[model samples]
Target: MTYFPAADRYREMIYRRAGRSGLKLPAISLGLWHNFGDSRPADRQRAIVRRAFDLGVTHFDLANNYGPPPGSAETNFGAILGTDLKHHRDELVISSKAGYTMWDGPYGDWGSRKYLVASLDQSLRRMGLDYVDVFYHHRPDPETPLEETMTALDAIVRSGKALYVGISNYRSEQAAQAADLLRELGTPLLIHQPSYSMLNRWIEHDRLLDTLEAAGAGCIAFSPLQQGLLTDRYLTGIPEDSRIRTSVFLDESALDNQTLARLHTLDDIAKRRGQSLAQMALAWALRDERMTSLIIGASSVEQLENNVAALGRLGFDQSELDEIDATVLDL
Candidate 1:
């Protein structure tokens, strides 16, 4: 059977202007950080991508080193793009990053001009696209000069390989510096991807959000569920097939007594609001005007559907907020 995206899908999602840019991103975006890798079945990957589109998730985030074998997620995404979504190219916001480890030796990783430019080219070839909607620096590279990294991003946009540029996992100082450089080059930074959730409130105290807003940049928070810790999936015990059980990124030992107890208090609040903890967590992440989108990953279509359902309501009230502030674990 062939899959065509639902015509009313756009009506279900609200697209917000990212900073001062002419682009508008959906409130919820899908990420290919997990499950859409080479290790996963191709049909399953295709179904997830199709389902996301069917649900009005127009933005798909990817990185150079996402797959277990590295570079395979983009390869898989490219296959899907070439097969089912070729004609709908203009309707999607496809993004890729090149910061962490990808290849080998010197040129395989980091934010240097050689690595950044070459990585985007390789990403384009792998994704079978002439250009990507957004290109990100993945992370700040202390070893590489900030100017060099910005220069490479400028060149990427100038070469017509990427339409816009973003940065991820950058501290407040680094984000300001990158914004300064990109502004000087006339490509002014558009968005910043940071890991922010109720449990991971480092951004709230770090002043990164304030800096981005002051610079007129948008922010899309990743891991908004804190790798599922914010959900009720672990209220009892670690599930056998959870990310903590199967992946290196999340660990089972994270489910300490204190963590579980804190989750119970938060879960109680969510239950009162007729929503799940995950939904409440996502809603909390998007409480601010600067938070344009909540970037989430799912192992199956069901999880994606459930997570994005958070947009159905603003689940928190004043008491819920006070309870959340009191119950959130101090990390």
Candidate 2:
């Protein structure tokens, strides 16, 4: 059977401008960080991407090091693009990043012009793309000069390998500096990708949002569900198949009884709002207008739909906000 998109794809989802850039990203963008890897079924991955597009998720985020083996996510997404979405290329925002350890040896990692340039070249080849809609430096490199990293991003844009450039995992200080350098070079930072959720509030204390607002850049949060902990996946204890049990980022120590209690408290608030814990988490993460979008990783089509349903009720009154803060912050 032939694949055709939902007729009213744009009817429900919302799009917001990325910083001051001309681009507008869907409020709930799909991320290919986990499920697009080689170990996942190809048919399942294809279904998720197609369903996401049908829901008005125009942006798909990727990194060069996304897969278990590295680079396989881009390879898989490229196959999807080549088949189902070839004609809709211009309707989507495809992004890829570098600055992680992609291969062996010194030149294979970090923020040198050599590594960034070479990594993106390999990324384009793997994705079978002439250029990505946005290319990001995945993280800050203390060893590399800010000027060199920003210059490399500028050059990538100039060469047409990417239309816009962004930075991720940067603190307010680092992000401010990158924004300045990119501005001086005439490109300007387009957006910032940060880890933000009710659990992780470093960006709030770090004031990264204020910095991006000042720099005329946008912010998109990843892990808003805190790697599935903020959802019902662990309310009754970790499921046998739950990846949260094995993640290096969220060790067992992080899921103590206190944390579980907090999850239940938060879920109670979500139930009042007529939403699942996952949906509430997504809505809460975007409460601030400065947050331009969110990158959500889904393991199944049902999960994707449930997450996107967050868009239906993104509002929270002062009382709801205070109640949520009291619960998550108390733990």
Q: Considering every candidate listed, which one attains the maximal TM-score?
A: 2
Candidate 1 has an lDDT of 0.89
CA shift at 96, candidate 1, in angstroms? 0.3
lDDT of 1 by residue, 79-182 (tens): 99998888899999999999998887998888999999889999999999999999999999989999999999999999999999999999998999999999
After superposition, the stretches of candidate 1 with alpha carbons farther than 4 Å from their true spots are 329-331
Give the whole-model CA lDDT for all candidates, comma-separated. 0.89, 0.93
Model 2 reaches what TM-score against the true structure?
A: 0.98
Superposed by TM-score, candidate 1 places the C-alpha of residue 110 at a distance from the truth, in angstroms, of 0.8
RMSD to native, candidate 1: 1.3
TM-score of each: 0.97, 0.98
Tell how far residue 20 is off in model 1, in angstroms. Answer: 1.5
Cα error, residue 284 of model 1, in Å, equals 0.8
